[model samples]
Target chain A: MNLRIKLIPYERLKREDAKKLVKDLKEGTIILVDAKLDPKEEADLIEETMKVVSTKFSGIELSSMELSELKETTNFERFKNMVIERIMGKKRGLTIIGPAKIIRKIEKNPEELLLYM
Target chain B: MVVKHFRRLKNRLASAIRKVFKKKKEIKIGLYGPVNSGKTTLANRICVDWLGEELGKVTSIPHETREIQMKEKVTIKDNGRSLTFNLVDTPGIATKIDFEDFLKFGMKRKEAKERAKEATRGVIESIKWLDKMDMVLVVLDSTRSPINQVNITILGNLDARNIPLLIVSNKVDLKSSSTSRVRTAFPGYDVIGISAKTGAMVNELYKMVLKKI
Candidate 1:
């Protein structure tokens, strides 16, 4: 299953920096995230980010939220509770739900997240 | 002042005599092609040269000529018999694109894809009008990549209908133009490569059009 690692603070990253990260991420690479990114300030950034991301990951399946741009933002406790319910014993690719830096968590212990989610 | 006045009167008398003897058939020519084929530029050229000196605004954006445009004039060579003709410039045929939904402040991905598909369908609908045309001028942009599904569909339809097709490969002045490639793309098809910007081969185009008529 596809999981998104949404980068929060999208406005902080330059276009070139985003490109490099996206290139390195490779297609179908999973991001295991802990929280959702700020939506209002980074909405356009998400689209621009996705364009670059798609160039690298054409046809790759996408699942879950990296940043919740949904009409209603899911609270942190509720999000975690829902993720626990959805991911328990599920073997799926992980994605970060917040800022680009959130990727660091996945980089550190991807295998652990894989075992859990 | 008297001599000048007489000259004006004499010119008017000559025109009146010419009008009495003119005989020419009005030809309705339609400029058609896949989207981004530069039909508008060619249409504008014909309008300026044959219909009037003033050209309407020309744009490079696809589907700029979304509706049919008509221009008329009397062919001078054939006396005053008016060679009035209508030029139908239709919308470009393209893959689906949905801007309307995307422009909405908060739209869904499903909605956006639907919009693109709708835009594409509109193009196909516009192309169906080709059946009513007397002659078609197929414009092709020489700078773009090789022709794909869109060009194939247009050519196949025109061939099936037995419509006289004049393939115009426009924008030849561009350095990256693929005139020869365009010819190879549609083998055995009569293709004319012309720089619409410089008016090159426009006269040749007129002659070809005249012969077809």
Candidate 2:
């Protein structure tokens, strides 16, 4: 299976982006959300991403959780924009959303996620 | 009531015996890193220390070993600590694999595309086998910037799994090599500097592995 990973920023999470996201999920393209582009709190990221990915696509739920966390960061050189993530009391990393079937399969056995690669 | 207690005691005793025996099993120590980070070279260094032979081919070209390579039953003993493991040298991990990236090395378009495909698949296989590893050596080019996405992603995956890892800051023979930079980037992990090609500090790594394990 061909996997298309879309790295959409938080600012561009508009209606057209939502359409493209749902369309890609239907076709099994992996969506990676980098919230640093717009800088939001962790709760807000979950809310907005869930709103776009969950209700529109029936039977598909957004498995939004803290997959990664920034326990400590001494500087803000590499991730300049994402520094706001720390300021907003949120961590930084990609929020992955995908087709319900694919997400289900990965959750059932994360070992099987390699199959898409 | 005493009979029921005896049955439960028996089950716990059996489980304890299984755990003690299982710890003696050989660990799978995977060599994981970005492309051309000297994973194969380090694997060869350890293999030569015990087996008197090298592991795989090394080249300046990226993705040279686009598959999993293993040497089994390599045991290292130092100062009462010993680690017997299967040394797995895996192809490097990259966030993106493109045929155009390979073309820079002066390869034909067809071969480059084929190499790119195999390299991408190799990355997936490397990740799939991550769960099987008892330990991992995250090799890095010491001179380069340690804040790249590839390094962070690799570390994040390992951290998620709670896998034990040692960061190898290799190629220290070069003028620009800075093991301290890599250490600063990853504060807590054990970052060792070495010239894998020259076997410098390789023995120290073996002893360190036993300590870490």
Best by DockQ: 2
Evaluate model 1: give its TM-score: 0.49
Look at candidate 2 and tell me the lDDT of residue B158.
64
Chain B: TM-scores of all predictions: 0.70, 0.87
Candidate 2 per-residue lDDT, tens place, A1-117, comes to 565667776455532445455566656666766532221122222223333332223222232223223434323433663565568544444455555445442231211122222
True-structure lDDT of candidate 1? 0.51
Candidate 2 Cα errors over 4 Å, as ranges: A1-117, B1-21
Alpha carbon lDDT at A48, candidate 1: 31
Q: Which residue pairs show collisions in model 2?
A: none
DockQ of each: 0.01, 0.05
Q: Over the stretch A16-48, how does candidate 1's per-residue lDDT look in tens digits?
A: 354444444453344333332222112222333
Model 1 residue B129 lDDT? 69
